[model samples]
Target chain A: MTTMPETVVPDTGPADVPPVPSGGVRWALVDGWTLTRRAVAHWVRDPAPVVFSLVFGVLIVLMFGYLFGGAMRVPDGGEYREFLMPGMFTMTMLFGVGHTAQAVTADLDRGVIDRFRAMPMSSAAVLIGRAVADLLLSAVSLAVMVGVGLLVGWAATGSAGEFAAAIGLILLLRFALSWVGVYLGLVLTGPSAVFGAQTLEFPVAFLSSALVATGTMPAWLGVIADWNPLSSTATATRDLFGNPGVGGEAWVTQNAVLMAVVWPVALLLVFFPLSVHAFRGLRG
Target chain B: MGASGDAVVVAGLRKRYGGKNGGGLDGVDLVVPHGTVCGLLGPNGAGKTTTVRILATLLRFDSGRALVAGFDVAERPDQVRARIGLVGQNPAVDEVLSGRRNLVLFGRLHHLGAAAARARAGDLLDRFGLSDAADKPVKHYSGGMRRRLDLAASMILSPAVLFLDEPTVGLDPRGRAEVWQAVRELVGRGTTVLLTTQHLDEADQLATRIALLDTGKVVAEGAPGELKARLGGDRVEFVVRDRSRVADAARAVARLGTAEPTADPDDRRVGVPVAAGATALVEAVRLLDAAGVAVDDLALRRPTLDEVFLHLTGRPADRVEVRK
Candidate 1:
């Protein structure tokens, strides 16, 4: 290539940047909060998806509580609606993975993720903010579901402490699964992947003990269901909620609370790093 | 922050992919002095976007040294990112968020306080002529408006260097012109711009210097006029009525210009660079008439970027394979 004579450099001074420490934990928190606000603002501007997801959750409850409740029985012969409530809460949390993935995929498709990656803000803040925002939405959805549950003749018979603990377990499951969503959003390709994820989540949600007793499943399937992370949370939340679908003979089911705590933590340990790696490796 | 006067310095950059997909850069070297636009002009898959992506600290290059805003792209991407801004092919702003909201969000991410961010957002909206639509969601804004918002988002920190990768690829003619006007304004404010485009006119209109890329390499680098000049003055092109007479026409026209004439049998056209524009046209016409070769079209035209691409890369610009 032919070279040209060097042109004169202009006399423009440095960019007008204020002196703000842009490193370490404080900036990370600031950046994370900023991105969280961005995600929340999107929810505010386009409330359809959020509204649809919440309505869909409620529809599931109504469909099962009234329409399907007569045909099903809890293993310990408790009210089917009571047994179903804790399961529904756990399912609501689990479905958050789909929401998280959809949001992430939308950002990626729109090249918003690329812009965020190119910025000087905290690298982890993108995923952190997304996870936190999704958690907030999940918390809202859980509260609405709890209200619907109570209206449908279900009660949290446990003490206030156990009730809080059940909520914590539910949110923890959501917090953990959100990383899976982040990783999937980063790695999956095409528009179909987002919708495809929604379809795939059905089996993951249904095969667990969220709506029925794992003991009712085939013996081989019951073992698998009993060990499912969703099942652990469902059983553990039922135990905490003092709802009566917690009966299972498998060691994993008997140790639901420990497994409930262990599953999400394990998922976090596995997926947090994976999500970070995926975020850092993003390229087109 | 650079010790040298250049805002961007790329040395022998190389990035290779696993397969034969031709998006890999061989060894690209570039220098863009401060406060000037350096256009990376090429056809699709010419590695233009790859270079910009690396310099913007968004991609990790396999090998090479790149310094943007005085920070090494590989070793200190954060520093480079802090000083540089990027407008990718897509608008990248949230479709659901209002234009003002998008800008303020970017401002806060840039570490501006709430009041300062709002003030800056207002200023940018005014500067970009987006104030009327500032409170409207970006999805409702026109293509030009969305691009303007994208530009405003990138300018939140008044970055020293801006990397625009095919910034006007999908816009209509009017939208393209709007973005070009916006870019000119930014350039006047002393932001060094590295713009990549497949549009020759876009490069011609905006870049003070253009680096012609082909097959992931800098095939030619100079000002637009200089690149055109490198093709050797004006050319008189003519089409023959009879395809068989194209050779005869070239044989006649060859004597009119000092250099040999090139003929296309398919188009029955012959073109040759000449020392004198109008005189060469008249002489060529007379010679072709004398040779009994009927002419279809004749004109003296400056070398186009398409010709420049052909002259430098031995192929038309658009024929290059798409890069991954």
Candidate 2:
């Protein structure tokens, strides 16, 4: 047999060439937008979770407004439906944490997350996309629940500007809570841990004044409720909806809107890094 | 050894989990030249996947240096990631979404525009022979179909370097051939492929060079022909009809060949290794016939990758345990 000379091929090709970029952050943003859009498309196809979350929020409002509204008196002069609307909004945000974990955990189990990690996109984009998609779904759920509440005798006496402020607060809270879900979804080992992480929402919601006024509760429990983050959001949402304020010291000083933003910001600050760290650890 | 430039260079790569006692990667060193398919051959727990993960920037190595396409894996992971496409052992396709949607999703993540992503998705689907199933949810596809789509997903960006971690482990023979064809096509297009596989034939068929890893270390590395040549000569075996004629057959075979004949007492079979050529077999048949021993069956076979693996690893390939 004739032996042909082996040709030595070049190791570096035009494909190995790197793009010249002035800023890495610009590439990250571009990649992040793509990831966000992909997540949105995923939500569009499988919308049951989104619908379930919204309907669940509406049921909670219905049960509380007509069944428990008369039994519990609002310190402010407004119908129970109006008093509970803000709390229902907070519940909507809280309910989203579970769905976020479920979606993320499913992705992890399916190896989709690992595939993304191997890509050239910004590492932070994965979590950011998840948060954005969940935030949008939560906003839609809030709008639907509010519309349903209005049909069930809930009325907002606040001006259009105040209504906007309440909606903004709801969005901010959801954005922050989405990060919490993203963090938990990455850190938790499996689906069971996701369920366990969701169990925290019940105590957090009940400990706050979302369902009742802190004044009527025992002094010790009232102290806990006053410090609860959800209570701060509920108080701020109530004021924006034009409901009777809890009055002096208890109402004005609560500053729920500011606290609502702070809680999520703090959560994102701590958990965002934690989630990234966990994702980095996934390789091990 | 030739000092070939490293398309993929890894040195002293070490990774451990939990503690020192825990199972993880050990110090692994690999050098893959450009435009070559280097097969990382090993059984389970050989740390082949871990090495690939580090090279792909999906996992960090605890120590040692890893450079892919001239960028440090740990320090400049994004740059390394930009150069590589990883098709892992498991199918990573989104089952709820259609195959077309899955491709689009990956394309978007690669930062391709909407129109470009759609175009690439269609091209990849057609290339992998999945165009018919593109609109169906991945859950509706068979295992082989899903694997093909998963591979297509990795190729969306047309990366310069590709890492395939057991890409055809569970595929049927037909599916395996299709994947092999796709890989050969990719290589023909000038993509450098670093693949890990348990199948010896796969390595022999596709890899320009094979690295046999055992217990997280390279026991042998060479071209398939070189490794097989090192294992010695061809194998010749034949069965005898009468159990009483086994020794007579062995003695007769020993007369024609300098090598000793090994007789299997239970089956009355004899086997011997001989130098390359049919002359040794012809001489053995003549001697056996002269001794009046009837042969039940006779066959001459060349060294297979399985034999090379057994010689290097000291255990059969099927005995190795793979982690799910």
Candidate 3:
């Protein structure tokens, strides 16, 4: 037989095929779904952390409802559980931000993020996918805490539509805060920095109206609480549940709702790009 | 790109870390042919991995023009990434997920639909001999098994070109062999591979062509045999019967050959370089006998790749000492 050619032909099979009709947004959604499902599956395998996180929420609710409920009366025939539920919901969303930082740090340490950076997927997909995943985990955590509250005699007097709207509002706030976690995770160098950032979560949560009504706090402190994003979510959830409104002005009512929506949107605007920039700067 | 085309081309690739004296790659140039395995041979700090990272689109080059599969890495990184797969020194699989799940995750990331992703994961598990542990958490995998899984993960996208940076660095001999077998199978399927390693033997075995990197430059490059042949001589080594006659034997052997004879004082051996065939061997023996120098043992050998590396780098291949 004749000698073979010096160079054989390469196999350029279907990778060179036509591009898919999917746009960047569709790709992001699919990637986000995949990432969220994977995160949930990981939680299924290790449920201890989920339980541990819920216990913290339960403790906060029980301590405030029993120890302080006798001294602080709920107007309009509302029970302490109703007042405590909204705060717990806000606390859950805020605490879930720490999980985002933890997950991103894990991905960074394991070099999974680097692997994604080298892939053909959209650059923004990595961070958005992670945020979406964290949001889903936050939803599950919120559901469990709410279910436990109901079992402990908490009830919502509002219509089902209002409750659904409250849930949507809580998710929007969590989704925004998730970007803060994503941004912090990308900017921090190691796990120790992540833990340090996590320490700030508890103080931020407690400083808001999560544990006590803003009206009972010092005048100056109450002003700060009214402007806090957690306060907005907590107040909105309390209003939807037909619980007694903590004394605040008309500005506080509109500002809380605006802050709740604007905080995540603003965070997405700033931290979203920051996360992408950090991802790009990883090797540097 | 065609097999006859250039699979990867780099010109003036430069990168520097942000500390004093922390440059990684400096003014590097390289080209890899399609459908061929190019071994990037270097010691720990020789910038081999840096070069591979730039080509694979995992790290950016401060200033350079790098084209992988005909796409500029800097200008069109996603396109470059689409055509190449990188199996870095560390495995990038999710430890919490099962081996099959990890594979399926990557498959989906490559845009393969659910059913196709599952089917591909099953096939890869079998191919990598991970079928038994397919459903087990990769956190429980041994180093070698994890490496196999990492290599298998890169193939899910069916990339046209593959980059392996020290793929067998921490593997046992058997694991290395298994990886070699898997690599050969990939080559048989027409995947172009660029593998970097500090192991000389690995380069000799796996590379169709090798580039020896020193400091920040490629000092020598060619096929192993061509590099060896360039050293120019069949090596002749023999032990002299008497230590005192070593001087005389050296002189006699030098006289019989065009090259100089070297004497090892501690081992009582004299080695001389000669051309092919027994003529020079017989002449050296006769000259030694005339000088009353007895030979205890004699043998002629061809130059090894180690000798080629030593001759080119002006230092022993295994004992390369990098100055900080």
Model 3 per-residue lDDT tens digits across residues B153-193:
88876687899988897888877877887777778887889
Task: Please rank every candidate by lDDT, starting with the best.
Answer: 1, 2, 3
lDDT of 3 by residue, A1-284 (tens): 01112243343323553334322888877876777777778888878887888787777677777777777655334566777788888887888778888889988888677677777776667778788877877787788878878987887889999889788889998888888898888888788998999999888887787667776778898778777788888887887876665646747755665666776687678877788788777756
- Best-performing candidate as measured by lDDT: 1
Candidate closest to the true structure, highest TM-score: 2
Model 1 residue A171 distance off true place after TM-score fit, in angstroms: 1.2
Q: Scoring model 3 with DockQ, what do you get?
A: 0.28
User: A177-198, model 1: which lDDT tens digit per residue?
Assistant: 9999888887887668877987
List of clashing residue pairs for candidate 1 = none
Tell me the tens digit of each residue's lDDT in model 2 across A1-284: 11111333222222423433212676556666666777677668777766677778778888888788888777776666777778878877887888888888888888788898888777777777778878878888888988987898777788999989888888888887787788788878799989988888888888777777877778788878877767777788888888755543654236677787787688778877888777777877
Q: What is the C-alpha RMSD of each candidate to the true structure, in Å?
A: 5.2, 4.8, 5.0
Error of 2 at B251 (Å): 2.4
TM-score of chain B of each: 0.88, 0.90, 0.89
Candidate 3: lDDT of A5? 23
Candidate 3 chain A lDDT trough over 10 residues, lowest sum: A1-10
- Model 2, span B218-260: residue lDDT tens: 7788888888877776657889999999888888877544378
- Model 1 bad stretches (over 4 Å): A1-14, A18-23, B1-3, B236-256, B261-272, B276-300
Clashes of 3: 0
